[model samples]
Target: MSNRTGLARVLDDLGTTLIDLVRGDPARAGGIGGVVIDDPHDDQVLPPRALVLGVGVREPADVRARLDELGVLGAAGLVVRGPVVLTDEVAAAADRSGVALLGLAPGASWTQLAALLRSLLAEGEVTDSETLGGTPAGDLFALANAVASLISAPVTIEDRSSRVLAFSGRQEQADASRVQTILGRQVPARYSQLLEARGVFRRLYRSDQPVYIADLPDDDGGVCLPRVAVAVRAGDEVLGSIWAAVRAPLPADRELAFCDAAKLVALHLMRQRAGADVERRLRADLVSTAVEGGAGAAEAVRRLGLTDQECVVLVLALADSHVDDPAEHARLLAERQQVADAFAMHLTAVHPRAAAALVGDVAYAILPTESEDRALRIATDFRTRIGDRVVVGVGPVADGLTLARSKAGADLALRVLRAGRSQRAVARVSDVHSEGLLLELADLIAERGDTLTGPVARLIDYDLRHNGNLVETLSAWLDAFGDVAAASAAVFVHPNTFRYRLRRLAEVGELDLTDPDARFAAMLQLRLWRPV
Candidate 1:
């Protein structure tokens, strides 16, 4: 029994509808050690988790001012009378403080509500009251197991991305869905698909109450037992969900206890998030250095705990064609982080040194392998697992010394995929054809005007001026590898007409058609120097 209580749990116990609305994140609201009754004359500050000030003594404005003065020492949330009208200023203060602003029932006694909270807190202080710090991951799992025991049901804790963080000991009555979800450490895609269609997530994010789902049918034609879930939130953001499957509905007491469990989960999740942030910072430095490549890069790699080995850098871009509104950017970023974490997790199973992170909208992975075949297989497997919307670009293999080159190759592959302007799941540097390479090279040298010179330009200029097909003819002939009959057929013309066009084209362009090198150069220029 963790002593931690979240603002959401308090609201759940009190019943949200009994209280009037204000602004704040419920997920960040809880973890209260004790309640403080604010006194205007008394100048004292309580640390984190203090839900300071009961109703009556302080007006909402006074409370807001007190909270502003408290600053970092402000309460986990503020309580008020239901009939008290809240102002925009108070609401704005709550938002800035990251504390929940809640109101009790219209006629509810503030002292009585404060006493109820004290009782609840006293009830929650278990013999095994866990403290923060140390190893948060281990503590989190232990807490999950305790929650399951308390509720007499199996419990699974998950992150915002629905990836399982921990699970309680399996009960004898555990259902197939529970077993499968535990085994995978994530909800099965098929089950997730079904739940998404049913608006389970939509309801989870919107409500503090336990969302109850009835009779979830499995693919094997078996129905799962009813499940109840509560979102583990931090402020307004949902950290994840805590779920329990049971044959019967959880009693009122048990439901309240479950909400208490959500607070403990939130505590553990906050710690985990802190740890991940540190890791991301470290990984970001390593990734930036590895991609950019400079002096002492090997030292940086070693610092990142990476070994010198052949590797391929993969770049994955999410499909965001319909993202028109600026508000959608944050959602896209969150989604990108989830996708990056998922990709990193999956890559780890395949290669020990594989690491992934999203630098903006693109998810990049540095995999410890040079094999193109392996890279392709990994890309295909990721696409199948992640979704078709993710487009993967695989770079050519390079050692630590040439990682910058690999990064460039990956970028080029992604560019080619984008330029193709078609639906493609994966693009590899190796998969790029000569024409694509020519086009890229042409773009690279376009400023210098070296590639698109002399004969090629002359032929292009003549065709544009006369509306003739000399350039097309030469291109077709070159593409056909000097096969006159094939070139003529490709251009939808007779061989005699193609021969005459070829002669005219060569004479006007001042070039020879016989030299293979010359023909290859001409073909390269033709593919690249498209008319403006």
Candidate 2:
């Protein structure tokens, strides 16, 4: 791959010399120094510091076939001598196969070709390390390839809204543009979700750490089913990510290696991004400073031509992702790079809190460049893909002083979604309920048996005896016992015997059976208890 390695070039030059030595005759010496053979399907033999010579002596077809068979062998060179003629196509093939060509005069000895090669190749040698140059990473194309090679993880470098900046391996595995097309066309809601999730991507970028999640192929929209994800980042800068959706999953070592690769990629990207940042920093910084209400600094920023309000500076985070080991964040993200690229556009807009993705199934993006319209689009769009399932919320935009508060509202909305299965996938700040009767009821259930064990005592005992078969037992008991026959039928005994069982009812019923609170508490405990 280096310019200094001219051995291949030399081989071509050697072919011409040999051909001239033979006087275009095939009868005297079978080509001694060069001949060509090609076999795409077969791996020809190659020896270290060796030469190959092929000789063709038959009719044109036979000569070509023979040349092809032997020329591909990595030989010092090939030679041919015979009663034959060479054509343009035949000569080209010989060069492509690395065969040096030689032809002896009709009555000449083939020894002449052998002597010729010995003199030319005896001086070949390797260049020293000092003469080598550094690898170039001056442009995006080189950087992308270098990143791909370094991380060995499927990853995509993205902008704030998770828009694809650069990525590798997608061409052969998946077409990212096709996905964007589908998102832009068939499912606009999902596309918006990805944009909202951009916040999540930014977090990984700024922190230069990996973000991990599960089953979010298009973090902006697609539901790949729950699977692990890892995203990598650098201080306020995002490099890329690596992901795997293996049905059986990857082993620990491979996962760790992925994290390491992500870190390496982050370092590389940071170096490049810093250079770019320097080139654009003055304009960006002035605008960003003025946007946060620094009117006094307006003069400095005005030169960049960006008005204060138009400048939006945001710290984005990838939420709704969970990683088993926080330490492996970088590696995990690198492994999932391909997936990240696929959904970069939408992930950029997610609220941050929902970013705890790897645990169960929630990913949040922080929308930095606030707007009511953009927020609404993200919410509605997110709903369509993650389904009416899961809560996707957008916080009202706020100036820097209260930006965190906006996210807090979105977090509350997500909480409402988690509390029950009936909530819509996308929610607005107005719909969130932090304090309500249902929440109180939920609170009571959430308290576990610590405060209300008496109510669940009998239910608990029943479960203990049946290997936790509460549903079946409840169904059977209600059918067999009726309102007043309860304890008697459960034991297959007479009514008086059941009255004795009823003695504990008042104490157990202290939870107020008539209250939805009590009913919910009872239901919750029964559902979660798994006694072995």
Q: Best candidate per TM-score, number?
A: 1
Local accuracy of candidate 2 as per-residue lDDT tens digits, 1-532: 2322223423333322223332222222222332113223433323332333343453555445554655544443434555456766666655555444445334333443333333223212222331111323222223334444544443344434444434344323333332342122122356437634755444544443344434445544565422223465675444445432233344567556556655654554565556445534443344334333345445543443333322122222233334788667665565333223222334322421111121113333333344655666655665455443234555666653443455556655555555453345555556545332345555566775344365666655655665554333333333443354763566565666444444434343344444666656565554444233
Identify the leading candidate in terms of lDDT.
1
Task: Give candidate 1's error at residue 293 in angstroms.
Answer: 1.7
Model 1 bad stretches (over 4 Å): 1-138, 148-165, 173-231, 237-259, 316-342, 370-373, 380-397, 409-418, 421-440, 449-453, 507-521
Candidate 2 to truth, TM: 0.29
Q: Candidates' lDDT values, in order? A: 0.72, 0.42
Ten consecutive residues with minimal summed lDDT in candidate 1? 129-138
In model 1, the Cα lDDT at residue 166 comes to 61
RMSD in angstroms between candidate 1 and the native structure over all alpha carbons: 21.4
* TM value for model 1: 0.56
Could you tell me every candidate's TM-score relative to the true structure?
0.56, 0.29
Tens-digit per-residue lDDT, 1-532, candidate 1 = 2433566655544443334446677776547856777655643335457776554634877768755754577567777666656688887777777767776655445555565565446435433433553223425556776788788998888776777666666533677677666545568888788889999999988988889888789767989888889999888878899988887889999999998778777877776567558778778667767777897678766765465788888988875524867889778777788888888866754654677777867877888876877887888898898776677888888886677888888887776776663356687876775535765786778666664678889988898889989988888888888899999999899999999999999999998988877887787666666654
**Model 1, global lDDT:** 0.72
